[model samples]
Target: MRIYEKVHLVVATPGRILDLIEKGVAKVNNCRVVCLDEADKLLGHDFKGMLDRLISNLPERRQILLYSATFPLTVEYFMKRHMKTPYEVNLMDELTLKGITQYYAFVQERQKVHCLNTLFTKLQINQSIIFCNSTQRVELLAKKITELGYSCYYIHAKMAQTHRNRVFHDFRAGLCRNLVCSDLFTRGIDIQAVNMAETYLHRIGRSGRFGHLGIAINLITYDDRFLLHRIEGELGTEIKPIPKVRIPNLCIRCRNNSIMSWTRWSLKASCIPDKRSLQLRLLI
Candidate 1:
């Protein structure tokens, strides 16, 4: 009905939109602008064929925009084939965000749960998002976190979109303190109160929004050593080994001599007991 009403704007997944196009329900032939957010993933193996088919249905003269943090060779190739003389604005020289403190702990595969438990106990987290590489791991880790007595909710790409939206909204609204999700949640979603985050390179960016203080702790098993090195190399940032002491609220500005009252905490130095968690602190 909405399509028949000639709605000017339409947002949908490639597969669904393609189906609609084939069914003669949605018309993108007159779409003036086509924007693909997360273009890297959209152009990847899974959706590439559907996305190509969908684009084929669009008017050739339409403006197309591709946005993503990183563009792999495949995405670049796709852009070359689809776009003519596309102008790009690259804002990043380094991959990692400035306000995030990155730390890594080496643990055995079986000890990952224990390491996570240790992080939960030692770190001062206001709200946290933990990323698991797989959907199965996301569910399993969320269950383990719940069993450990921490409030947790999990989301994966396989879940219904409505259910995913509900979980995302509830988490953003502070209905829960912790969320476990697959890589689907790592892209472009901003939660200001999330001071603690766990995952790989892209996932770490979930914390420290717009120059705010945040911490990223990576629990790495032996199998992940090569991946860690590669990530460090690609990002051009070192992930220091976590210190034994617990750190309270970190003020990036404080460390950079922005405030006199906010005590500077060093990663190398032993920490004193403090009340401030990683969330927010009023420097007094």
Candidate 2:
């Protein structure tokens, strides 16, 4: 076996990746396209120095593609400094996201978990992820959900690396209906309040992939009302405040599956319905 293997793609944390680059062990001078998956989170002031150094070392004419959920002021500044005539694609407009529906439900801290549970029972969500702000909350929420007999799992930075891998795969395989996690879900890439609007958009973008219908629901308490309004104003999209409803006894998986089946059936019909029709019909 060769002691050194040739690599075409490399993924690692910032510090480690920077270490490799500094040592000339990870070469990207010939790279045709340099993509930053979480651009808004990474290109801000926090990573400006590292990012500028890395970009300075890359091919001068390489294509730079940045993907971020929310476009922010810092991101614009970063583009001005590093990117030339870069094109942009905005997912949000004055009225709505390109396709995603966002709801900012004001659930009091005491009823927050219950409200989440009620949503699971009511909505026909295919793949949903619930975000909390801390690891301890992730654990506590997961436990409470299981007690309610919901098929749910959680991932946080505190878990063993191996175990975290298993949980991620389980989620991708659709083994669980819900994934409860903390904002640490996007670790190493700083996602602070300044860029949290983008962070929320990024997380919700996880679901509703491949042009399928998706929903993003944020459960915030009174304290977070200011933050929620800030995000809404910045995005220029409405997060409809949904009234709290009683928890239903429906089987979430069965409801989700049935709804999906019906959607497929409808799509195959001679008169195909528009997106608005489907959304209104199923409230998916």
Candidate 3:
């Protein structure tokens, strides 16, 4: 008779993995290595308990690794509890990526879709990821993009895991030119073909990934004025305005014909004019 010891490698969400452990389907007693991506989010209030429980089931001699672009205060608790003199390697001295050119267009809430349409026509996008603030917005924006005669797909945290995985896989495989998603896809998505990203959040990291050249375009409204400035200060980078854009026969209803110019943009501050004026802001 021959006896064999089975060894398994599993990659799963903390909740799913914990469920399998609870059901006696997964044995982590001999687990050698546990790696957590987006460590800040996992250590947040929502998943911290489950992650703690999962770690408790692993062997005491196991190696633990935490990885994230930003390590917030939330991760301190987990490190203190689980790690013994852990080492951290921070490759970024600044928050923003050097390979990414950041820009923002100030538009009214209603004109956002129109502005985005213009950008789609103007920018040379290979594969782009558009990020919305909420799941509802993700769906709505995806619909609008599709209506604009573009190939698009949408994903969010609220969607089924299987569906989201399929959408992500298809998008990465070049099945779609654009993907509309929420912050759910912000971290750990590496698509080299993505040369442009439109985001309201600081998730512009989606582009310029793996040391590739890319651009990040943000659609800013009056409400997002403070946020734009705060991000600049935090990232220690400048966002600048795009050069003059000549909107020919676009019927934007501006006083100076259809020609819209970006003026008085600042590196130290964001000049958010009233809703009536259209200005483009750029961050470099």
Candidate 4:
């Protein structure tokens, strides 16, 4: 076992960390920093008991930072219960990331796969992650992409921890060119946020990390128009349609060192926003 005394950092889910603390395998009273990442989810009702127990044992004078993609009122409730004079940094509320470019492809349900395949064949991907809403789709998409000769792999909540660990390691090592995920690898809650508009901001954030450039493309049909509009309103940035998009490839890195090249990747499809149908939902 790694010596806990010498360990300066520990990353764990609340329930497991609470168990470790209860068994004296981990101690937090002397800890100087306690960060609740995706703290909105941590402070949710599902984790209320474990979170309460963990926070109760933390050192009183420590720096407690709560980070979340979107701060919901439940998080505010937890802050009132525990923190003193917490400062709110609503960065996303006021600004958009210039590092990443977002786009959407409107394809028929039957044509989505072909469009995705078309993307892979054209772009010179350094690495990219594709998210699906379901584990079954993650597996099926990974299979289809692999069969098309793209170097790809997948991860989801249902996979065993050991296998998931291996996949993560492989991805970081650059053994894989693309990853198909079910949002299991992404942070933030699967539940409703204050509004769903920032969903793309956080989801696309997985790319262009550490101040690098990234691109996010969503495959949407008629079913996703409303959700897409809400996302646009939230970011105040328009997601360009694939047909009228200026870039032929996904190389948007701002800190480029001669790896910047553009190609013509045009796919003609239509996703006209119907102003009358742009209804925002689940956004408080």
lDDT of 2 by residue, 135-235 (tens): 89888988998899888889888999898888877776768766777665643322111112665555553333334454566777778888878777766
Per-model CA lDDT versus the true structure = 0.70, 0.60, 0.66, 0.63
> What is the full ranking by lDDT, best candidate first?
1, 3, 4, 2
User: Where is model 4 more than 4 Å wrong at Cα?
Assistant: 1-37, 42-66, 72-85, 89-96, 188-198, 244-264, 267-284
lDDT of 1 by residue, 89-145 (tens): 996444455667777777777788887776666555667787777899889988998
Candidate 4, residues 21-48, lDDT tens digits: the string is 9999887788877899877677776787
How many residue pairs of model 4 clash at the backbone?
Answer: 2
As for TM-score, the candidate ahead, 3 or 4, is 4
Q: What would the per-residue lDDT of candidate 3 be over residues 198-227, giving only the tens digit for each residue? A: 132247654433444456767777687787
lDDT of 2: 0.60
Local distance difference test, candidate 1: 0.70
Q: Model 3 lDDT vs. the true structure? A: 0.66
RMSD of 3: 10.1
lDDT of 3 at 232: 71
TM-score of each: 0.66, 0.58, 0.59, 0.60
Residue pairs of candidate 4 with colliding backbone atoms: 248-263, 248-265
Worst 10 residues of 1 by lDDT: 275-284
Off by over 4 Å in 2: 1-37, 44-70, 81-96, 124-127, 183-196, 244-284
